[model samples]
Target: MIETINSSKQAIALEDKYGAHNYHPLPVVLSKGEGVFLWDVEGKKYYDFLSAYSAVNQGHCHPRIKNALVEQAGTLTLTSRAFHNDVLGPFEKYITEYFGFDKVLPMNTGAEGVETAIKIARKWGYEVKGVDENKATIVVAENNFHGRTSTIISFSSDENARKNFGPYTPGFIKIPYDNIKALEEALEEENVVAFLVEPIQGEAGVYTPADDYLRKVSEVCKSKNVLFIADEIQTGIARTGSLLAVCGNCTCEGHCEKQDTYTKPDMLILGKAISGGFYPVSAVLADDHIMNVIRPGQHGSTFGGNPLGAKVAMTALEVVRDEKLALNARKLGKLFRIRMQKLVDTYKILKLVRGKGLLNAVVVNDTEKGSTAWDMCIALKDNGLLAKPTHGNIIRFAPPLVMTEEQLHECCDIIEKVVREFEK
Candidate 1:
């Protein structure tokens, strides 16, 4: 019989002994989660502020999504792309219509979705845009966090993620984020096929750009005849108070192409919360004109369009729409910012607070090398909330979107109490 682990210390030791040290996770051993709260092995319950990096926007173990997974699991889990599955067709139709895209190519993870978008863009460049073969180049923003794949990391400005990971893949051009002139200049190179960017720089400490940045980018890409790819893995599915971060300030429940704030991208890459943290599911969406460039065997994943994932993702999206998570995120986000701004004004330890929706960040008034942000997160853990730091000094707070206003106020109170005690 297998021995059961019953303590946080034991769980930590088990991971330390066996797991790779790639991630320096916060020392919290979670055993169960429901809605916006998690229970440690010791039965201590705490509010989950990270929401698995915005993958649980529908909250943990969401019954609707969970039921979908279970029902599909018992029926048809996967038939692979070699044969058609009943769920894949419906899912494709649902998601494409949901996002106002002509078609969608399903993939398994956010990184895979990004990789698929890159492939699609390059193919569209060669077949559609007449870019020279083997010379199609994609433009990316500096400090962008797409994924850790070799090709994705090749253009990364973070040396820590890039160090010793070369000789890196070529054909990528790096430009400053949120700068229109720089993008125009890069597009002048003639070989630039696509401009890929995050709607909001989530991993780079929730760096929300100017309101007009994406709108202007859309115009520029159209004029230059280059594909504009929005990697919304972290910011999509109502996490940024919109269906997609590229939607800007639009309050629509679904993709509204007619909305003025909607800066539609040529290619949309979505993942993370697409399955509500229940399973790994991702998608790359585009219109027929651009997506038709992909031919059979050019790209595929075995688990990409599996039936179980399809059902779960469909239900997950339904939850977001039916519950109007985007509206909630928008209202709660305003409240969160107001609460955080007050703390920023009064506390010397806080530098500033910035973000949209529930994906806010509080920058500690210390250097990037300082431990203050990490220390504060630890303090929050002890006081019944869990958050994590990014870029050393910025602590990101993205709780489940299902969080109630009363619960939000309670969490804010905990934050205030922790800050007060820490300052003393």
Candidate 2:
């Protein structure tokens, strides 16, 4: 690896030469990271405002989590569900109890967790909800970012994500986001089994719905007897300042509080921070009826419940509670957004800054579709804050959950400088 990666430029050139051009990532070659900061190959440092799309909620290379990974790796790694591993059972117990779910079906990626949830929901629809065999439809919100799986993209409303990707999978119907009316209308069709949605559409530029939108949607799904599935891959694990973003409360505050209507979801899909930025461990959690519906041989993964992932995830959850990242996000997020709003107020090029918790985005002036967001990201990079664009005109700014006040201020300073310069 050392002989091959002699320099960052060489690595970048090698990737450009050999790898697929699937992602148009910012041209910074990160070499090391800790907490909320990262260093490029040339030793130039930048505040990590993206946090691997909210995967590092526990921070980069967290010590305790790293210890767990190292320890478990030395003990046991993969046992492949053919036989039960000691760590998997205990890990599942901790996770389900922590999340208040009766059981958890683990997977290696957010997208796979989503696929598992879809399978379980469809099966439940057939067996429990009583939808027709193959015709059972799952309602999804337009512009939602679930994952990049084929079936996921089939229901996607984004033209770019869907073009040339199918021979699409059927049985998903896209409804307008934030519109309770569209959801209600969709549910009018009896084949609706579940409604899969992101609490805040993160990849679509941290687009949060109206305050009561979640409550209203949950009520609609409840009234219609359809399961409410929350794809919290990006928004879960305190990214939005709650255990789950759909919990509707950040900072444990009742700001998202409501009657019994807004309290729960039938299926919860989690990833990113589940392993504390260590490995790719994701899961689908549900109560007895929904989770139990999956019998042996129904669903499984090679690395899903592996001991390494199990230990890492358990410690990761503990670190979140021990470090109080949720409360920190609540406090820092308000400051971050408030500071960005001030920048927005002063800058002519920025349209608005909006979000909940650390998951936030700035709407750049639509100069020409995607140009403004890309240029602004480049500017932000130059100014020492690292963020990326979602759509053409929106740049999301999500720092690590372990971000400190001083570090957040430094990032905000960079952003302010970039916007001020952009106004020129």
Candidate 3:
């Protein structure tokens, strides 16, 4: 057997020899993780900034969530839908209440949650909203990263994500993001069920829509009788300085203060952090009318709301609230961006920095012309910070919510150090 001391090297070798080469992940073999730090099999430690693509919002292996998983595992794991378990109902109630939705549908992954929502939105369109069957159209945004499901990829404008993946799902319309004019025009089309979007397009380099975008879009959806579904899988769970980015400060420029108005999108899709980086736990939430449209057998997953996920999701949510992660994200995010801007000012290759809350990005200028968000990411990893490039020229810096002010500064220093080397 391969020795554990060389586990990372051995694991990578095995994966290269056997696993499909789908992802081009940074060459970092993690042995264990806690809070915002991960250690390699050789015990070299690094600060994690991507936070598992915003999945580990409460931080890697949060103690409370880990405990919940342990205790629940020893109790009940899966009961399926044939017989309900003890935790599903409680998790449903806890989450629905937290997000201010009338009902909740639990799923295992972000994409699964999105699929559940799409199904619910279409049903709502036909049964309640009174759109004709099989004619419901959902509006998505260009450059939006909803998920990689076939139904999702059908509307994706990205060539890489959609290349050769066909025949694709239909009934989705792609529109330019942050353009209220296009959205209004699309809403006028008949049989339009919902406007499914991310509050802040995370995979698109943490692209935040124009200020007042969410509230305005919410108004548009309401006036046109189309559901506004926010796919918060990456941007929710306090990643964006709020319980949900859509909620904002409840007083921020783009957000709605009243629970009655909070862009409360007809449907709310959640995943990732819902399990605090443990088991995959996703949820779809909506008003009764919208949720009621999905009949039981029509939508269900074997591992969707199993007992283990339920317990993990319950505790996972509690960590976000109890830790005041939203406040921390907002406060530290501001500092991080400010510090990044300062670094940008001192370097030419580092072109710009922009983002909201803790989900931020730094644009790298091309040696020839274009931006270099990717090359610098390699340099960043070498400097003991693990971040990935988005598109080509944008590198996102999203640490776990467990990051402290001191640690944030240290990460900033590391970023500044690596970025200065890129300056030509």
The best candidate in terms of lDDT? 1
User: Model 3 misses residue 130 by how many Å?
Assistant: 2.0
Q: Tell me the tens digit of each residue's lDDT in model 2 across 1-424.
A: 4454657788799889989998899989999998888998888888898999999988889999998888888889998999988998999999988887889999999999999999999999999988779989999988888877899899888878899989999998889888999999999987999999998988887889887888788889999989999898888888887777876664452224343324578898999998878999999999999887899888888888899998999999999888888888888999998998888888878889989889999999884365978988888888788889888888888899888888888788888887888789
Order by TM-score, highest first: 1, 2, 3
lDDT (0 to 1) per candidate: 0.94, 0.86, 0.86
lDDT, candidate 1, 335-415, per-residue tens: 999999999999898889999999999999889999988999999999999999999999999999999999999999999
Q: Which 10 consecutive residues of model 2 have the lowest summed lDDT?
A: 253-262
Please provide TM-scores, in order, for all candidate models, with all chains considered together: 0.99, 0.96, 0.95
Model 3, residue 345: C-alpha shift (Å): 1.6
Ranking 2 against 3 by TM-score, winner: 2
Put down candidate 3 lDDT per residue, 91-203, tens digits, no spaces: 88988888888899888989888888988889888888889899999999999998899998899877899999999998998899999999999998989989999989888
Q: Pick the candidate with the highest TM-score.
A: 1
